[model samples]
Target: MAELLDDLRAETASFEALLRPLGDDDWERPTPAEGWAIRDQVSHLAWFDDAAGRAVTDPDGHRAALAGSGRGDGPGDVAAGGPAGSWVDALVLEARGRTPADLLAWFRTARARSIEVFTTLGARDRVPWYGPDMSGASFVTARLMETWAHGQDVADALGVTRPPTARLRHVASIGFRARPYSFAVRGLPAPAEPVRAELTMPDGAMWTAGPGDAESVVRGPVLDFCLAVTQRIHLSDTALEMAGSPAREWMEIAQAFAGPPGRGRAPVSG
Candidate 1:
């Protein structure tokens, strides 16, 4: 849990560095996320982070707030085929009038409070989340994943290439473990066969998951796998190598996020 919190703090700092220098126009610029601007992205993160803190400190109040927010269904209530965008859109709407500075302040405060709350919890303590309860480690990792993914959108909007770091290992791990949920959310049966993930990290070290003898294998740079699973980059645009049917199919529809199927990016053409 301590290690995960360290990684989460690093990820948060990295993301904040990107947002710090953006001008008002940059904050309003459209990101790769459909219909969401940079401000919207930060707002969404702030809302969730605040909610996470509330979940730890006051579960009943958190549930009551969400219920009274006029958002019809919480993340846990959405059906497999439901419109995930609508739920997010409603949340963003609450912060619609806030300026970039306001959004950033809100995000920073919420994030700090969340980290503080997490630090005081016991290792075995579970926190309520949008979807389900999560351990302290898993909860922090989830925040890291969301921060990194949305940070990608901000980077894309500004045409800035944020270099991959070892922090991405967390995102990749989530993506790899989410393979089953990815299939299940789409109303498809998860393949019984295990799929192995062999990714080269930014520092040239290999991160392997699943059995070495697994027939289905996904091998590539860890950044590519993370981007592919996060739906930020089209699978066709990545250099990832898929060696089996299950691996290939999973790559095609990979979604590390908890929601309905995402409208993944389209392949870029020459």
Candidate 2:
């Protein structure tokens, strides 16, 4: 339980280190996520972190918040509680009034509050989210995945190369678990074909999934697999090896987050 929060805090610190050095102009720079600037990414993280805090400390309030996201009573409802896609617009709209320093402060404060609340969760506890309630460990791991995925956007925008860490295992696990959701969200039937992953971590150890005998297999560095599922990189742009039609198709449409299907990056190659 303690290690879960520790890893999450470490992950948050890694991403925060990137933002702390950037100036106002850097904040305005657009990332690969369509129209989202670096500031928008940070703002989005901050907003969700705060909502997650409410989920831990005040479940009823969080439920109301999720309910409010679907209410189309007015444009304000979404800004108040919408999902990421629409929330991206709301964040961008608000970005006009925010300075880099102000946004940073918000992120720092919101995450701190959330962390404080999250530390109280037990292994058996459930945290409500956009989808069903997730266990305490899974809830925390999802935050780590979100931070790293969005951090990739910030890194790409700044043309920085981040060294992959063991943390990618978390993202890969989430990606593996999301295979069914990735297909279901697209209204496609889940493939009966089994898929496996044999990813090499930076330290040279393997993080594997599914059966070794499965005909459909995805092979790559753990980082590439994570980036693909997060939609931060096009599957074709990666050195990932996909065997069989199901593995290839799954990699193409892999989405580890809860939302409408993401507009994943287009091929950077012909």
Candidate 3:
């Protein structure tokens, strides 16, 4: 639990650190997320954290919140956050009246409250996410992926690189497990064979999954695998080696991070 909490803190804090240093001009900089300024991105992050916190404290309250806000059924799109353009518009509108300091304060408060809810959960607790249900630990892992993925967007907007964390290996592993689901979500044929993941941990230990075969092999530092899964780094951009039919297909549709597909910016270059 402590490790999970620390991971959560690190993930959220890194984002805040990036947001806090932005100047007025920087806030208006375009991110990889289409039509979204850096301020819009931060506002979306703050909004979701606040909304999810409400869900934890009062699930019914969130339903009412959504209802009262007239966001019912939420833009009728695959993305849980709403239509891609709607999110950008909503975020931009929300940020219009706020300063960077105000955004940071809201971010901090929402995140702190969200963590408080997590601290209260047991290992076995599960919660509903945008798509499938996830155990509490799984939910945290998903959040880690999103944090890193979006952090990449912010970093790309700023032309700065955010260092990868050892904790992200957990997210990559989750991504590996989620390949079948990814295919299912896309209405593609499920892999006839399982792809192997051989990860070299930061501490020099190793983790292996499935059987290495014609399917695929993901190797090198665990961080590379996580980076690829979160779309922070392209599969072709990293040292990770992938082979086989299913592996290649999985890489194309891989979405280890949470949220709806199609919105998160896929890697443009290897």
Query: Alpha-carbon error at 34 in model 3, in Å?
Result: 1.8
Of candidate 1, the 10-residue stretch with the lowest lDDT total is 72-81
Cα lDDT of candidate 2 equals 0.82
lDDT of 3 by residue, 96-146 (tens): 788877877877887788888878766667665454556777766665566
| Candidate 2 least-lDDT 10 residues | 72-81
TM-score of each: 0.91, 0.91, 0.82
Error of 3 at 168 (Å): 1.5
Local accuracy of candidate 2 as per-residue lDDT tens digits, 131-175: 667788888888888889888888989999999999899899888
- The clash count for each model shown is 0, 0, 0
| Clashing residue pairs for model 2 | none
Clashes of 3: 0
lDDT score of model 3? Answer: 0.67
lDDT of 1 at 106: 96
